[model samples]
Target: MKQLFILFLFTSLFTSAQTLETIFIDNFEDGNAYNWESEIGWEVINDNGNYVFQGTGHRWAVSPTQRNSNIVITGKFKIITNVFHLNLLENSGRYFFGIHEGGVYFNNDETQIEDVQKEISLNEWHDFEVFTRNDSLAFSIDNENIISYKNNTGTNINAKLAFECLDDAQIQIDDLIIKREQIVYNQDAKWVKTGGPLGGIGYDVRVDPNDANIIYVTDNWAGIHKSYDGGRTWLQKINGIYSRTGSTNDAIPMFCLTIDPNNSNIIWAGTFGMRGVYRSTYKAELWEFRGNGIPNVENLTFRSFTIEPGNSDVVYLGCEWTLFEDEVPEGANGASRGKIYKTIYGGLNWIEVLDADALVRTIIVDPNNTNIVYAATGIFDRDHIAGSGVFKSTDGGENWIQINNGIKNLTVGDIEMHPSNSNILLAATGRLIGFSREPDSENGEILRTENGGETWNEVPVTFPSPDADDWTLFTYLEWDESDSNIVYCGASDRGFYKSTDGGRSFQPTTYNAPFINAGHIISIATHKEKPNWVIANSYGGGVFVSENGTFSWSDASRGYTG
Candidate 1:
């Protein structure tokens, strides 16, 4: 079924002013339909030096494209036989014109609106144009207005243009020109949860680099949800995903997800239930176990995951083991218990590269230099005997060294590399949980390193301190791709914070943004092209969206039951 209704999210560039821009043009002169969704029975053919689209046989329809604003479509159309219809379709209603032997008739869906007895010859091309602006529409043929109507319904824009032939009618279309007018909408548009995986904690959100409409979100207990329509709806893709208990019926607790930059279809996922790592070559439709080389997969829970930008096959996996009360293994003190695995052959096999006493929380590979890698460690379990800080591996995880000279808090939850600079980086310190009792369990601070971890400094954050012994960990950190100075920090208990001065200072948003207050923010996502859009996933509150950056937020968890 065609999705007629969709949430049209316009960029901020179009919200302030009106501008006319040519959006689409298809002459079929390039011998390709480009974005036109031509049906099976439709084919581009050349007739006397003119290239045009024609219906080969049987009932067929072709949709050129769709727009979210007012559009003016001009094209040439010719009918070979039978009946044909030109449709401007939307969820609210449909404005279509039917050309039959009787006459040219206009209808708002099934209800006929107008009819004219003008004869249109078969196999004779005629200039046709469709203009839809505000609540008025006009259809012109041969530069003469044939049907003019004012739509009472509030569906003047956001419609798709399609050509259909009925009763084996043959048709030919060519020289299509589509133009869209920038729409000025209300700035008070609020976010609403479309529909997707719910009931479990959404840990990671990834948008396809090649196509923004395709989205992937990992849930702690829902395996993975794939959205092909910009997240309006989702489907659970867990064909080969399962929990550690070997129950395929139950959704696996997916902790992390990463898509190969070179190939969006190749996906890598990590589990929190000792399931190791899994890979999907065909997007997230299916999964296969790819944790062959790592030792003791049943005891470790995986979280941090990253792929080298230089080489997609070169990947890193971070795993950690939980330590219970007084259940630490003998001789485990001062010894690394958590493991970091490296796979150069795309997860076909893995090798234990580094083992740390602290849980490996995050891994970052330098885009400028893939050989240089950084792994941030922190422990959430009972034992905090080993030092938890950032580790640097300059030779592609072959060897490792600690680089926590100036960082006061070592439990780094997330690290973000500057988009245009490699040395400039930011890390968010997290808190420790479990049975172990520590006087200062609350750790919520932003640390910056401009010299590639050689020296680190703290970025002052003004968030109110949590109660004594209560943990308030900074769970994630993300920088606006369009502006590196705009950084966002997500906390486990302190809500959200933003920094506009390149991490020099941070301001808390919970005081004014009540929708995200006290919510355990697990992940923050930002688009490089869309700086005004921000999405933050709360552990229990579901999702929150900020249209004008992180200034204000609204609850976007309508479909989410979690």
Candidate 2:
């Protein structure tokens, strides 16, 4: 009897190893029409594209219904060329490797992949392997180790695989394979860096002011990530957060992060989803809930937060609330809402200063007069009916006045003021999506006021007319402290420009500068201790640091996140 049982066990093991399920086999001899179904959800543009099944081109789509836990997904992908674009537009242009398990997709879609290993080649056949055992998952590409994921919730695992395309990219694919297997869990593998500028996605990077080495990054749907040595080593920080709640999505969207400039020990993170702002005081070792005075209305999200420069106890928050026609139920109470709040005593006391049915985009304090403040507001829906335009408050947060006399039909996005000259103000605005910029529109002016907010004039700098679609939607302007007349500005697609005569006339900086084509300078901070040192934040690209003004640049993103 013992001998018979041993033989049976051996047979079972061998059979299991040989008969791993084949998911989808695509030779791509014809076109993607036969083996794959092309479904474009929210892709901006779709052009037919070829994709290698294994070399960062293939993606999975888990069925919307399933309840299994342990799953094994393996395949063989043959790359036909050395270079190929992995277009993920079919799945909202977001996901790469999606696992639909127990009716829950890995990142809310079957298009999401936690990690990918870069090894498969275009001229050869390679093995692709993924295994989910217990509450963990592993991926191997071409027999090489790739990445491992720990499934804390032990959700069901049921998913399918497919290919994605974007911008008419092209490549060849063949010999696909898959299997179900059980394996030991491991957490020692590194993450394969993928996706970026290719998609409109951006990352929020947090730098420890005291130690620039410690950095935290959050991808669109990948959840919170941490890097101890700048961005060299990264780890997923999704312990308390769900990778995928409803669909097969595996991301935690985060917008703004603020580390107490005075105390690097304190950290604040504003995230979308059910959970709002998260606070960590012990250097992010642990986190606690801090969205006390904030609203919990549906779709209301916290976008940005600013700490009082002199007083860490004071904080301001900006939120975006909107009600889309599709978002409303058959019958609802009212349209969506948005508001901006100020907390004089940390988060203990909250006051709503700007309450509108629109989103509060940007807020800034005059460097010369801290009590003076400015805020830009815009409607959130397609109607674009009411916008608060630019608001000014001379007595801190006590009172506010509409400063839109010379501004008309403006939907403001960002606001900036000269460090030395509080009277010099710059604003970025846009027309309704489908409309064109009118000469009379107040949407594209680098407004200047030599005497506070009493009056304004169009800076002589002839900005690309609002009709220039290539210009950045949310443009940024900054005045050089070394020379007040020397100002620097950047747009999303229009590249970077410099003004030596205080926004009167502008010229492109040297092409060699890092600010060129950098896109929306998120924040520009001149090093107080180091006079000529200026740091500029790029949305998709990392940070660019210049020692000799904005003339030359270096990748300061060594410790920063993408």
Best-fitting candidate, measured by TM-score? 1
Task: Give per-residue lDDT, candidate 2, residue 171.
Answer: 35
Over the full model, what C-alpha lDDT does candidate 1 score relative to the true structure?
0.71
After superposing candidate 2, which stretches have Cα over 4 Å from the reference? 1-200, 203-219, 223-246, 273-275, 283-285, 326-337, 366-371, 379-383, 394-398, 420-424, 431-443, 462-474, 479-486, 501-505, 510-526, 529-562
Can you list the residue pairs that collide in candidate 1?
220-253, 336-357
Instruction: Write model 1 residue lDDT over 1-562, tens digit each, in one string.
Output: 1111111212222345676666555566534444456678777777797768887455445464544456788999888888788888786776789876556899987999898887788878899988776666667788766776666765455677887777678888898877778656667886765555333566777778777667777777656777676555667676545453435635467878888877888998988756557788789765656766665445577877788996888889987776653656554432224678888877766888998877887898999889899988873332445656899999999999999978876777788888888998898875644423444546556789999999988887775554521456677888876688889887775567888887888887741345344256777777766766677665655666677877677654444332
Model 2 over residues 1-562: C-alpha lDDT tens digits? Answer: 5335433433442223233332233333222222134443211111244333322333222222222234454544434433332211222222234221111123324434443334344444556665544444555555554554543555433444444422323333444434344433445785655423322123345666555457665544444556675445556554323224225554466656667765778776676544356656666654444555666554666656767667777777777766667754333423334467887755644678777544666677665666887777652122232556777788776788878766544566566676666677766555334333233332344556666656666555544455553333435566665566777765444455677787776666631444444544555544333445555555555555666766777654442233
Best by lDDT: 1
How many steric clashes does model 2 contain? 36
Alpha-carbon lDDT of model 2: 0.51
The per-residue C-alpha lDDT of model 1 at residue 288 equals 55
In model 1, what is the error at residue 116, expressed in angstroms? Answer: 67
TM-score of 1: 0.60
For each candidate, give its TM-score against the true structure: 0.60, 0.53
